[model samples]
Target: MSTARQNPLSYDEAVTWIQQFSKSSIPRDQVTASFSRSSGPGGQNVNKVNSKVSLRLQLDRATWIPPHALQKLKTSPLVNKAGELQTTSDRTRSQGKNLQDCYDKLIQAIKQAVTVNRPADLEALAKIEKR
Candidate 1:
């Protein structure tokens, strides 16, 4: 067995993580992103600067995703694009923070995607709902 720890977000590991984490049935082309000017603070610099980041992940093409994972993401308030999730930050009035916020959102999305539900817990919920 390999003793290596899986680092999903590492620069070198992005491709591998994408393959494993995303639904295999979905084509890679489905995901896309766009960048635009971030609002708030930074005076005149902010008025002319594009500091915000937007990422869109297409779910329709993602055939490999499990139903539960899809349901969770669909129900999530933060999710967009019928499946896309977006995050933005202009707290520092710097491009760096905006970029970091985008990355942070991506990481959080992956973690949410990979969450596993225990069978027993689900069964209990089902019983409670019936009552």
Candidate 2:
């Protein structure tokens, strides 16, 4: 398990956290991948190659994600009732490429979930109150 970032982070801190977290890799033990034959216009290649990759990240096992992000992620469509973040890729005929695509999707989803809107400034609030 990895240390998680705290909630209510400043805008700069959240940006920095996103950058650092994006570069870091998810633990392999927390992710599982399964491959199946792709269903698309590849003719025999699609029929023969099990290139479609289905990646599942067990969110409960990933203690690295911040609590705020995890809470948001739970509402995302990528997560099912099983509390797992599921992604799939059939963009390529190679299993490796498809698997990488799934990883990319997962990473993007997590980053999106972690992003928070900047808080309104106290001065701005005060000015609005004067109206």
**Predicted structure with the largest lDDT when compared to the true one:** 2
Query: Which regions in candidate 2 have their CA more than 4 angstroms from the true location?
Result: 1-6, 121-131
Can you write out model 2's per-residue Cα lDDT over 92-125, one digit (the tens) per residue?
Answer: 7789988888989999998887787898999999
Per-residue alpha-carbon lDDT of candidate 1 for residues 3-106, written as tens digits (9 for 90 to 100): 24221234334445445653343354865656677677778887788766665666655544544455566666767756665555666566766766666676
TM-score of each: 0.55, 0.83
Best by TM-score: 2
lDDT of 1: 0.59
Q: lDDT of all predictions, in order shown?
A: 0.59, 0.84
